[model samples]
Every structure is written in structure tokens, then in C-alpha cells.
Target: MIYVNEAADPRLDDFRDLTTADRRPDRPGGRGLVIAEGTVVVRRLLASPYRPLAVLGVRRRVEELADDLAELTVPAYVTSSEVMAAVVGFHLNRGVLAVADRVPPPTVESVVADARVLAVLEGVGDHENLGSLFRNAAAFGVDGVLLGPGCADPLYRRSVRVSMGNVLRVPFTALPDWPRALLGLRRRGFTVAALTPRPDAVDLRRLPDGATGRVAVLLGSEGHGLSEQAIAAAELAVRIPMAPGVDSLNVATAAAVAFYELTALAHPGHPAIATPRPRQRTDGGTVGQ
Candidate 1:
């Protein structure tokens, strides 16, 4: 590790003033670097496909990554916490940061080619929600994530930290054609199910369990949910049964529930499936009181 006491060291430019550094290159004033914070995330970044640029951290934190850095030729700049805080533009309690150049995401066709279940997102622009959704997707063995329009870049620094770096592991790509691209998935034998709160939708738990065939769960933004055009493109609509007067769930939380349900239905032996939910009637009442 190279020791540096100066915050203005020319080599440390990649980590300077990070608040706006996470923007995509297409956005104004963006470098499009994938930044991983803390040891856990930094380690995952190192293992990810993105090429490592450099690492900036305190000496202790840098030493902790010795094994990971042993074979890597990139520079690891070790410095005091004060210097790190100044360079990073904020006092980072995690004390370690790693930066990498963004790589091209896999093609949607490639991601869908070998997947049993996938998470298809639309208008989920919140970084934390996107990150949490990915973490849930990884937790439930989701094969991949397909980004529809109005989605945020999952590689943003906040997203990377929030996802515990699972974004780096999850294969995702943009579907620039919006709802039209969903037709391609349907043609490929995927049952595109849009998750919505409409009264006419099928109850999520009521769907057949231990089912066969590929499924894609379409999710929408927290504010407005899925667009009508997008929902119309789906093969079916499903909803999680909730208490009366409750409208919906946070998109990521709703996704976790949906992912778990799908996984349980497809693979009954999966350990994370919860206890069976009570059956509900078509009129929104409990069955066989």
C-alpha cells in the first residue's frame, strides 16, 4: 500500500468530492465510476467484473484488504482518516472506498436466455429502493433484473452501498423499448406478470404452487405504480393480499414478498418461504370464516 498524508494528492482524484461523482456519464458532470464503500462492499467490487481503478482508505482499512489486494496491481493509497474525510468531501465512518470504471451491462437477451425467474423494473428511480430490490433479488435467487424506462443506475454509490454490492453481482440491462420489449420476453415463453393493486388482479398467494415455466415479475415505482400501458403488456396481473384500507407496499418490500412467493411456488423445498397465507374470496373477504 502506498502511504499518502496529503488529501490533494493528484493520484487520488478518482475519490475526490464524491457527492456528485456517482452520476452516470450520460448525465451532466458525471464520471460514471462504480464506487464501493466499506470493506464488505469494496471486497465485492474487487471480485466484480468492473476493472479496479484504485483504493483510498486508512492504513488499517487498507491492511484489512491485503489478501484481496495481494494480486491486484492497482494502487491502494493509505492515509489518515482526516485526510480521507477531506478527499471524500464527507466523514465516512466506513473509512474505505474503492472505485472502478463502469462496464457494459449484459444484453437483456443474454440475461433472459438462461433464467427461470427475473425481476423486471419500471420507473423505480430511487437508488435505495433499486439497491434493496437487487439485494432481495439476490436473496431469492432471481436470475436477473431487466430495467424498463425511468429506472435509476444501480451502480450509483448509494445503491452500491445499500445493496451490499449485490448490484455488482446481479446481471441487468436496459429495455429501451419500454413495454414493447416485454413482448419479446412473452414470445420467449416467459409469463410476464405485472404486480398491481387493482381489485381485478389475481391474489398473489392464490396462484398455483410448484408450477413450471419461466416467469417475469414486473414492478413499478413507489409513487404511481406501473403504467397502464405496461400493465396491459403483461400476461396477467397479481396482487399481495393486504389488510383493508392499506393501499400498497414500498416497491422493494413488495418485490421481496413477490420474489419469495415465486421462489416458493417454483421450488417448494426452498427454506425461506414463509407460512401459508390465508385464502381470500373474490370480494376481498376471508374464505370460509
Candidate 2:
């Protein structure tokens, strides 16, 4: 561990002025760095395929990650909280931060090759909503995510933080040619089911038996929903039933509901959707399994 007394130290450049545009990897003049905040997210970054360049935190937070750091040869910068705040351009309550270079993303074919359930997104420009969708995908065991078009970069800093770092865990790839690209998924035996709120759409709970086979749930931005062409390209359209006054749900919430339903359908008896077994006493002990 290196104790740096000055915030101006050259080694701390990767973490300097994080809020500025130049540090935003998704924008022009950006370094394209993958940053992880807090001990939990930092630990996840360390475990991810991305190679850690450096770690900066106060002494206590640094000590908390001692074991994770021990396995790495990267520099761990231990500094005072005041210095850390000054270096990062804000008071980061998470205390610890790690930055790594972005790695090449997997191709659509690779991510879909062996997947059973997938989440396909279009025009989901909001980073927070995209992040929450990724978190939900991870929660429900979604095999992968396919970005159809106009989706935000899942590795953006806000997305990484909002997702509680699940973005690092879930595999994702970009789909080419917009709605037309969906045909590739179909050829691979995936039934592309688009989620929409149209009255004529099939109820989400009553999905056809064929939907239980390798399925891809196509979701769109909440404001406009899926484009007509996108919906028409899908094998079927499904909707979550709501009250008369409610017309739609936030994109992330809607994605979560769809993911749960589709994943449960695809993998019956999964822990998340399975009914809990009643406990009964056996000859030697209580049993539930």
C-alpha cells in the first residue's frame, strides 16, 4: 500500500475530477475507464475480467479490501478522507474506488450461443433505468442481454453504481441492424417476445407454451414504448395487466416484471418462482428439501 499525502500526486490522475466530461469514458476526450465505487463494487471489479489499474481509499476502507488487494499487483493508494475528497472532486461516502481499462465486449452470437432466457432492449437511453434492468437481470438469472439499438452504455459510471455492480456480472452485446437483427435470434431457435401495453397483446401470465422455449423479451423505452416495426418483428406481443388508470410502468420496473415472468416460465421450479415446501419432521430431524 502506498500512502499518498498530496492529492496532486501524478499517480492519482485516473481518479481526478471524475464528474468532469473529460473523465466520462462515454463522451468525447474521455479515458474510457471502468470505475467501481465502494468496497462492495470495488470487490466486484477486482473479481471481474477487467484488469484493475489502481485503488484509492481511506485507511479503513483500504484495510477492508486487504485480501482482495493481496491477490493483485496493482497499486493501492491509501490516503486521508479529506485528500480523497479533494482528489475525486467530491466527498465520496463510499470511501473506496477502483478504476480499470475497458475490455472488449462479447459479440451478440457469443452471448446468445448457449443462453436460454435473454433480455433485448431498444432505446433505453436512461442510464439508471438501464442499470436497474441489469440488476434485475442478474437477480433472475438472465443468461445475457442484447442491445438492439439506442441503449445506453451499461458500463457507464452511474450505471455501474446504480446496478450495485451487477453490470460487471451479466454478459451483454450489441445487436446489429435494429429490428431486422432480431431475425438472427429467431433463426437460433429464440422466440422473440416483445413487451407492449396494447389491449390486444397477450397477457404476460398467459404466454403460449411455445414461449417457454428459448425466449428473448424485447423491451423499449418507457416514454414511447417499442416502435411499431420492432413489435411487428417479434414472434408475439405480451403485456402486464394493470388498473384502468395506469397505462404503463417505468421501463426498469416493467423489465423486472417481464424478466421474472419469462425466466420463471423458461425455468420452472427455479428458486425465485418455486413454491416453498412445507416443513415436516422426519425420524431423525426436521426436513423441507
Candidate 3:
């Protein structure tokens, strides 16, 4: 571990002014680095495909991650909480941070080639909602996520934290050409179903028996719901039955309900959705990410 007494040290540049660092194009040093906060997320970053660049933390937080960092050659800067706060420009209760370079995302065909279930998104620009959707997808055994136009960057700092780092684990790729590319999923035998609140839409719980096999769930932003073109492109439209006064659920909550229902129908008795014991980490701590 390297001891850094000063906050302005040149080596700590990556963690400097993090509050404004992630704004794309509008801010200086907004180069889009993959940053993980706290020991849980930092450990997840260490295990992810992204190459770790450096880590900055208080001594106690650094010590807690010793097992995970033992084999890594990345620099671990040790400092007091005051110094860290100065560098990051805020009081970060998470205590530790790790940064990694962004890597090229996988192509749409590659992410979908061997998938049985997928979540396709359109105009989901809210980072927290997008992250929560990924967490739900991971929980229910979604094979991959295909991003249509206007989705937020899943690797954004807030997204990574809100997802509990599940975004790092789930495979996602961008789908170019909007609703037109949805035809590719049809050609590959996926029953693309759009989730909407239309009165005439098929009730989600009563999805037809023919809706089995490979399936793709199309979700849109919470505000406008799906576009007319997107709804028309899908083979079927499905809706979650709700109380009379309720118009719609939050997008992420709606996704969780849909994910559970669809996964139960698609892969009955699948281990992913079954009750399980707490995950044990090799380092003896319970795994949270």
C-alpha cells in the first residue's frame, strides 16, 4: 500500500473531484471511468473483467479488502478519511474506491445468440431505474439485456452502486436501429412481448401456452410507456393487472414482477428463483454483491 499524505498528490488524479467527473462531454475529466465505491463494490470490480487501475481508501477500509487485493498489482493508496474527502470533494461514507478503464461492450447478436430469456429496453434513461432493472434481471436469471435507443449508460457510477454491482455481472449490449432490429429476435424464435397498461393487452399472469420457449420482455421508460411503433412491432402486448385507482407501477418494480412471472413460466423450478442460503465468499465474509 502506498501512503499519500497530501490530497493534491498527482497520483490520486482518478479519484479527484468525483462529484462532477462522471458527467459526459459537459465536464472536464469526464472520460467515463468505471468507478466502484465501498469494499463490496470494489471487490466486485476486482472480480469483474475490467482491469483495475488504482484504489484509494482509509487504512481500515484498505485492510478489510486485504484478501481480495492480495494478488493484484494495482496501487492501493492509503490515507486518512479527511484526505480522501478532500480529493473526492465530498464525505464518502463508503470508505473505499476503485477505478477501472471502460471496455468495449459486446455486440447485440453476440449477447443474444445463446440466450433463452432477455430484457430489451427503450428510452430508460434514468440510471437508478436502469440499475434496479439489472438487479432484478440478475435475480430472475435473465440471459442478457438488449438496449434499444435512448437507454442510459449502465456503467455510470450511480448505476453501478444502485445495482449492487450486478450490472457488472449481467451481459448487456446495444441494439441499433430501434424497433426494426426486433425482427431479428423473432427470426431467432423469441416471442417478443411488450409490457404495457393497455386495457385490451393480455393479462401477464395468463400468458398463452404458445408464449413458451425463448422469450424477450420489452420495457419502456416510465413516463411515456412504449412508443406506438415499438408496441406494434412486438408479437404480443402484456400488462400487469392492477387495482382500479392505480395507473401504473414504477418501472423497476414492474420489471421485477414481470421478471418473476416470466421466469416462473419459462423455467419452472429453476434454482435461481428458488429460496437459498446466504452466499459464502471464499474470504469468509458473506457475499453482498
Please identify which of the two predictions, 1 or 2, would achieve the higher TM-score against the true structure. Answer: 2
Candidate 1: TM-score? Answer: 0.90
Q: lDDT tens string, model 3, 114-229? A: 88789999999999999999999998998899999899989888999998888888899899988998888988899999999999999997899877678899999999898999
Full ranking by TM-score: 2, 3, 1
For every model in order, what is the number of clashing pairs?
A: 0, 0, 0
Off by over 4 Å in 3: 24-30, 274-289
TM-score of each: 0.90, 0.91, 0.90
Backbone clash pairs for candidate 3 read none
Q: Residue 62 of model 1: what lDDT?
A: 90
Q: What value of lDDT does candidate 3 attain over all alpha carbons?
A: 0.88
Please name the candidate that would achieve the greatest TM-score relative to the true structure.
2
Query: lDDT tens string, model 2, 176-228?
Result: 89889888788888989999999999999888888987999999998899999
Total residue pair clashes for candidate 3: 0
Better of 1 and 2 by lDDT: 2
lDDT of 1 by residue, 1-289 (tens): 8999999899998898899787556644564688999999999999989999999999899999999999999899999999999998999999899999888778887999999888999999999999999999988888899999999989888888899999999899998788998888899888888999988898886764323368899999989999999999998899989898996899999999999888655544455553444578899988652
| lDDT measured at residue 125 in model 1 versus the true structure, 0 to 100 | 99
